[model samples]
Each structure stands twice: as structure tokens, then as C-alpha cells.
Target: MRIRYLLLDVDGVMTDGTLYFDENGREIKGFSIYDGHGIRLLQKARIGVGIISGRSSTVVAWRAKELGIEDVHQGSRDKEAAYEMIKAKHRLQDEAVAFIGDDLIDLTLLRRVGFSIAVASAVDAVKQEVDWVTKKKGGEGAVREVIDFILSAQASHTKTPFS
Candidate 1:
């Protein structure tokens, strides 16, 4: 099956895996423009994108909203539940989904998806389990790199809105 949906883990895959807390006890995160543009390309190619994060942050929510990602599942202690909900919501099968992760919290879902990916700086266990390990580390063009690979594999890169 082709990759119809791409699921992401927030902390490591989209960010540098660093947690920042302000003096006001609020969390902040940095997202990459390259990843954002990649997501737009994927969407233009008629692929869906979503987020499933173990930790909840408004920054993530804002970013997802900005990127037009509707299937946002944050603060999920049971990621399987989120995964199931996404599949059910979209009437998707395991073969139609792809997940990118860098930690153990994302392992079960990653293994279950059709295409599993790990960022270069991911834990050894995660890297070992994923179908592909990116050359770029998380938050440093890894997501974009993965997008290009998947689209290229499916021979759908030309379908994307951009050349």
C-alpha cells in the first residue's frame, strides 16, 4: 500500500529532543521550516499528516494548527489508542500509514505501520527497529529527507505541487 498518512512524534522527530521551560513554567519548542514545507508538499500530493505526542504542549498545538494538521493527538499516555483513533477516523489500515519516531514511546506504533522511520540521532534500539534511519538528525531536515524518500519510492514526487 502507498503511504496515505504520515504520523509524527513531537519531541525528537520535529524538534532537537530538547525540552525548554520558561521561568513561568511553560514549555517551548522549535520546529523546522524544512519539515513544514515537506508536510505541505506531502499534503499537496494528497497525503495526510498528523501528530501523536506523549507530552502536551501548546506550542505543538499551535504549530499543528498552523500546518493544517487535523489529527493531533498529544498528551497521549496510550499511543496505541491515538493510533487506533486515527485509523478509525480516516478508515485507514496499518498498511496505509507511516510513522517517524526517535524514542521507545513510539516503538510499538512505528513497528505496526507500513513504513517505519527513525531519525539519525535516535536511540540505538529505535534505529535498529525502524525500516530506515535518516542521515539528518531530528529537527535538522530529517523529516524533509524522509518525505523525499517516500515520495520518490512511490514515484509520486512529481505529483507534489512543487518541482
Candidate 2:
């Protein structure tokens, strides 16, 4: 199936599932430049990107804003619900959506979406269930690997002006 939307899980998929706390009890996350540029390339190819994270973080909101991704759904414990809402809002079917996740919380959506991707560092169960397991670990160019696969599958990478 042709993919039109790419849904992501932030903690494990985007940030290596590591949580840091400052002295003031603020949350901190390290984002990958490779992932950011991959997202940009996906957007340039007209593929919509959305984030559905179980935890709420201002940093995530800020990152999404910086990436120009409007479909940000944070603190969504029930990611399937968020997935449904995203599908409805975008008027897309399951076959049109691809999901990348790293934990069991993402199982339902992963099994339901057309393309299911799991990071190399994902739980064993997650890796077993996914259509593809990224060679790169989360927050370490895993997202970029997935984007490259998607763009290549869609034959959009060759058409993109940027190298």
C-alpha cells in the first residue's frame, strides 16, 4: 500500500526512551538532527507526519512546532484513539498510514497500519511484530533510515531536489 501519513511515538522512537530531569524537575530530551531532516524530507515529499506520545512534554511540543508538524497529540496513552482521530482528520484509511513505535503500547496501531516499523533498540516483541526493524537505534538515525525506506519505496527520493 502507498503511504500518505507517518505517525510516530516520541519517547522511544524519537528520544532513545531516555528521560532526564533537571534540578528544577524539568524534563529534557535529546532529539536527533538526522530524524529532524528526515521529517523535513518526508514533508517535502508531501507525506504528513504526526506525533502521538504517551507522555506530555513541552519540549516535544516545541520540537513539533519547530518541525512545522501540526498533528501533534501528546499524552495519548490510548494511541489507537489518537490514530483514529488522525485518520478522520486527514480522511485517510489504515492502508495510507505508516507507524513507527518501540514498545508494546504501540502494538495495536503498529499491527493496524500499512507499514509497521520498529527501532533496532525496541523491545524484542516489538521487533518481532514489525514489518521492518531499523538498523539504527532510536534517536540515532533510526527515523532517517525509515524515511529513506519510505521515500525509496514511494520512488520520491530520486525526485527530491535536495540530496
Candidate 3:
């Protein structure tokens, strides 16, 4: 199936799943420049990107804005509901959506999406459930790898400047 939309999980899929707290009890998350570029590539190819995270963080909002991703849903324990809402909002079919996740909470959406991806550092169960397991770990170019795979599959890169 052709994928029209891509959904990502922030903690484990975009970040290294590490939570850092400052002395003031503020959160700090590290995001990859490669992942940000990959998101831009997807947008250039007309594929929509969105984020659905179980935890709420201001850093997530900042990163999404930096990437120009408007569909951001944070603190969502029920990712499946968010997935359905995104699908409905975009009027996309089940077979037209791809999701990458890393934990047990992401299972339902992973099982339901057309293309299911798991980061290399993901838990065994998650790896076993995905259609593809990224060679690169999360927050370490895993998202870029997935983007290259999709662009290659769709031949979208043929028209991009990178080609």
C-alpha cells in the first residue's frame, strides 16, 4: 500500500528515550538534525508528518514547530485514538498511513497502520511486530533511514533536489 501520512512517537522513536531534569525540574530532550531534515524531505515529497507522544513536553512543541509539523499530540496515553483522529482528519485510509513506534503503548497503532516501523533500540516485542526495524537507533538517524526508505519506495526522491 502507498503511504500518505507518517506518524511518529517522540520519546523512543524521535529521542533516545532519555528524560533529563534540570535543577529547576525542567525537561530537556535532544532531537537529531538528521531527523529534522528527514521530516523536511517528507514534507517536500508531500507526505504529512505528525507526532503523538505519551508524555507532555515543551521541547516537543518547540521541535515540532521547528520542523513545521502542525499535527502534534502530546501527553496522549491512548495513541490509538490520536491515530484514528489523524487518519480521519486527513481522510486517509488505514492502508495509506505509516507509523513508527518503540514501546508496548504503540502496539495497537503499529498493528493497524499499513507500514509499521520500529527503531533498532526498540523492545523485542516491538521489533517483532514491525514491518521494518531500522538499522539506526532512535534519535540517531533512525527517522532519516525510514524517510529514505519511504522516499525510495514512493520514488518521491526522483523529483527532489537530493536526487
Candidate 4:
């Protein structure tokens, strides 16, 4: 199956699952610059990117906007619904979509996607459902690892060697 789009989870998959609040009750989530650049590269290569997170945060919206990701679905308790919306919006089949998730909540989408991914620090159950497991943990270039694989695959399909 060919992958044309990537759907990612936030929290554990993007920010190491650590939630910090400042004295003023402001949420803080850290993201890796490596992952940010990877998303930019993927966009340049014409691969669609989307974020489907369970929680809603202003930081997530800002990040998605900065990355040029138009498909941002937060506060989605039923992620499958968000997934369906993206699929239909893109007119893409399930086999052409790849999803990276880290926990049980992600299991259902993982099972449905053609290429399912788990980060190095994902739970055992989530890892078992993944087609590829990244060597890097979330918020630490795991998203970049998957992007490289997809870009490499895309490059190879076009008969261009990636060094």
C-alpha cells in the first residue's frame, strides 16, 4: 500500500506526554525542532499532514498553523470520526494513510490504517499493533523518523535514490 498522508496524535506522540502548568495555570508543551522541520519537508514533498489529538490546546493550534497543516482536530473523544472526516476531505482511501499513535486510544485507528506506527516509548499493546516502531521516543524526533520513511518511500517510487 502507498502512503500519501500522515495522521498524528499529540500528547504522548508529540510532547512526551508531560503536561506542565505555570503558576498562572498556563499549559506548557514542548515540541522538538527536528519534528517541526520534518513536517515542513513533508509538506514540500506534497505529502499531507494532519493532527488528531484528544485534548484541545492553544499551543496545538498554533503549531498546526505554523506547520501548514490544515487538518487539525483537537478535543476529539471519538478520534475515528475525525479520521473519517480527514479521509473524506482528502478523498483518500485508508490504505494511502499512515497513522502514528502511542496508546490504547490510538489502537482503533492504528488497526484501520495501512501503515501504523508506534514510538519507541509507546505502551506494549500499542507497539504490538504498529507496522513500524520508531527508534526515537515522542517529542524527540519520532515524527521525523516516520516522515523520513515516507519521504524515502516516495522518493524510491519515483526512482530517485535517497542517500
CA error at residue 157 for candidate 3, angstroms: 11
TM-score of each: 0.93, 0.94, 0.94, 0.94
Whichever of 1 and 3 has more TM-score, that candidate is 3
lDDT against the true structure, each candidate: 0.90, 0.91, 0.90, 0.90
Instruction: State the lDDT at 37 in candidate 1.
Output: 97
Query: Candidate 1 lDDT, tens digit per residue, 1-163?
Result: 6788999998989999999999999998888999999999999989899999999999999999999999999999899999999999989899889899999988999889988999998999999998889999998989999888877877754543122
lDDT (10s digit) by residue, model 2, range 34-90: 999999999999999999999999999999999999999998989988899999999
Ten residues in a row with the worst lDDT in model 4? 154-163
Worst 10 residues of 2 by lDDT: 154-163
Instruction: List, residue by residue over 60-128, the lDDT tens digit for candidate 3.
Output: 999999899999999999987888889889998888888889999999999998888999999999999
| Per-residue alpha-carbon lDDT of candidate 4 for residues 66-91, written as tens digits (9 for 90 to 100) | 88999999999899999999999999
TM-score, predicted candidate 3 vs. hidden true structure = 0.94
Clashing pairs in 3: none
Ten-residue stretch with the least lDDT total in model 1: 154-163
What are the clash counts of all predictions, listed in order?
Answer: 0, 0, 0, 0
Q: Score candidate 2 by lDDT.
A: 0.91
